[model samples]
Target: MNNTLTNGLGLLSLVANTGRAHGVTELANMAELPKSHVHRLLQSLVEARYLEKDHQSRYSISVGALRLGRELLRNIPVRRMALPEMMQLVGEVKAALSLAAPFGHEAISIAHITPDGNLRGSMESLGSVLSAHASASGKLFLAYLPEDEVGEVLAQLDYSGGGPNAHRNAESLKAELPQIRARGYSINNLESGANMNSFAVPIHNQDGKVFAALGASAQANELSLKRIAELAPILLESVQRIESTIKEENP
Candidate 1:
């Protein structure tokens, strides 16, 4: 192996594979790296396409590391074309809408739209994950995920209590899948927090594989089961627009 692979990232594969990025100090401690050596090694890896920096200066595997995935979606037909329509859906709801894409061990809010004046509260809390089980988008995400990955997250769940949907167990969620698929939307009620309701639907790519989930989140005052029912058709229409756009772009 080359020096960069061996001495730099190889010793730190455990941390890299952990999926959570680290800073110089935490990575050094985790990898038993000396303070002096950590910075240089991380710098080298960052330069060599093995690592990337977040806004907070934490390091994680870079997009360059996902070349195979890039190739898979190189012309990622759906995500590319769905932007305008997804934005329009959020506008129609006059609430915060977001799209969460599956990352290795987590999800990323790949798209979100907040108009100049929104009826619901702030959406800044998104783009970061709290619980993969509690949020509507998360449920849609986990529910449709590959079986093994679903097992991994469920296995690591802290069953003690109190999270997005702490009351639910894996089996309960599994049971809900068919309905979510049947209904074409995932609804989460008072699960993320008191007086909140979130709803989501999956976005399928050209090959008919689910690529992301589109969701809307709002305070209880903003969304009632009644309101969600009213909004459902519009949202599904939005999802259709996005899927069609993606295929058009990629093809």
Candidate 2:
């Protein structure tokens, strides 16, 4: 890769990671690139439809970029590959299953499956965003992040959006992350929503980094901490299967 291409890709990554629009000067300052160089790269990206320049001259990732992401996801096979294992886990646990990914400071459900019968908890729909501080899937993501990044994420959380059981401040939440890491999973005991309890374990990619969270949610009355602990092995087993499948497809 040439310097120009490298710099352009870096700038694009910076803008996409910010999850917000930015002006050229701001982007240049953030990227520590020359203003002129940044402007040229931005124009190139806009021309390629990888980014869009707004009326205010601010730039953001465009629909074309999203299309590229969707195309990549379509080929990745995680959703299709993981569905069988998810279904098996859901059947065994008799709870709602979810696959979620970190989206900035939030966790968004990418896929979900509810067990048959009336004993079901409220499940976040696909694309539904939830407080990372309160949800098991979100907390799992947070636990794996660098400490500084976790603090930054916690600073942005709306404690009230989490329920009364959630840690209300970063300090408290930070203290709990170690335990989650040690346990290799996270639990939301009526934290995200009343009577909704969930447990989540990380699904790793080929590099062993957390690629996503695989979780199960049920009514608190139906799933207790002891029960969650008992079912965790099953959840972890499914995660391993998903990870192995991802490795096979990606590698």
Candidate 3:
């Protein structure tokens, strides 16, 4: 373990999370590090362009961090390949779209897009979690995991949240996996959020294993189950394009 790197990152995170600048002495007090040590670490970060020091001798996250973030987003093949198609889908369907992949027992959104002026079903809120048993994308991801892994992930899930239609336990949700697979999509009908109906389809890798889930969400009145059925072909076509793009770029 490189203690220097770890401590530097810890301090950088503390400053970045606060969304403001901090002087070395203030950061040292906050991080419980020696003032001189904090100054040295901050100087190193500034040299690396990860932090910028102003005339006030306070440091804040800099353009280098933004560069790294942009690079990270570009390098995520699924998110990169899916974004253009997601944008097109948003134009056609006029709904919010999200790309989610399974992470532990939850489905975390890697990308989110919403039509202009609507925030009801947008999944852009930081730190929002999709419960594995209830969300459309979560259920689609779970439906494709191996049997043993599914059981393990299900055991770790928290079924206490979600709407009145959500499954109360693993057994109930587990029983629905086969149907989700057979139908080629998953639906969250007031299960993850009240008055919101979200639908998702699996995005498979070159080897045909599900890699992520592409989802759409909107107020139930706007995206009724009937409308979802009408939109299925379009969504699947987008998935096909994304998968083809991935194979071409990565192959």
Candidate 4:
């Protein structure tokens, strides 16, 4: 192996985020790596489940990559502390409970509690890439990623259409993000769905940087917007408990 290999970790990261569905050649161009080298590197990354190669030879990152990151906090106390409270809240709110933690440029779901009594939110999978532009947890995590990553996410969010409910006004959402940063919550509607609403609040680290988002989703009918407002305090309180437990264990 060349000691100064051009095919390395940095190139892998580049391929993972260059808008998905890329072949090794295109990835190499973006990564400034050579074709043969990048192709072999991607094969290795794919074997390790850090990347996935489609039947068409297009490549993107795998959920297993996020799973590896999640394992770092396998003992995360917040998840345990929040689970029961999330369960209880889902019962009370008759909605779905969702948690998202930072996964590079995306917020990957670390935990979720679904209501069991014949009620469900649209989301059922544990590892789907919920839209940062349309999903509550996605938008919430978008605000907490790195500065440049946040800019990229926001720019992408711009194309989601200015409709009636979620992020109806681009200027307004931009103005609100600062407020969200100040207050520690991200709330919006994609406005694409007429009968759905979601609310998300950030879970802060001891350093006060947001590392996760606690979210609840429901039909606009079963859980009215006013009801969500009433439920915000309790949802936030659960988040506090979750964070406090994590800090106590780690710090």
> Which prediction has the highest TM-score against the true structure?
3
**How high is the lDDT of residue 197 in model 2?**
95
lDDT of each: 0.69, 0.84, 0.85, 0.67
lDDT of 4 at 131: 57
Candidate 2: residue pairs that collide:
none
| TM of each candidate vs. truth | 0.68, 0.68, 0.72, 0.66
Relative to the true structure, candidate 3 reaches a TM of 0.72
Which ranges of candidate 1 are over 4 A from the true structure? 1-26, 31-37, 43-79, 115-126, 146-149, 159-165
Residue pairs with colliding backbones in model 3 are none
Question: Which run of 10 residues does model 4 get worst, by summed lDDT?
Answer: 117-126
lDDT of 3 by residue, 196-242 (tens): 89999999898889988888889989999999998877899999999
Off by over 4 Å in 3: 1-68, 117-123
Off by over 4 Å in 4: 1-33, 46-77, 103-106, 117-124, 130-134, 138-157, 161-163, 168-170, 178-184, 190-194
Clash statistics: count for each candidate: 3, 0, 0, 4
State residue 122's C-alpha deviation in candidate 4, in Å: 12
RMSD of 4: 5.6
Error at 18, model 4, angstroms: 12
lDDT of 2 by residue, 88-195 (tens): 777789888888888887788777787762322232276677677889988888999976687777787777677769988888888899999999999999898878
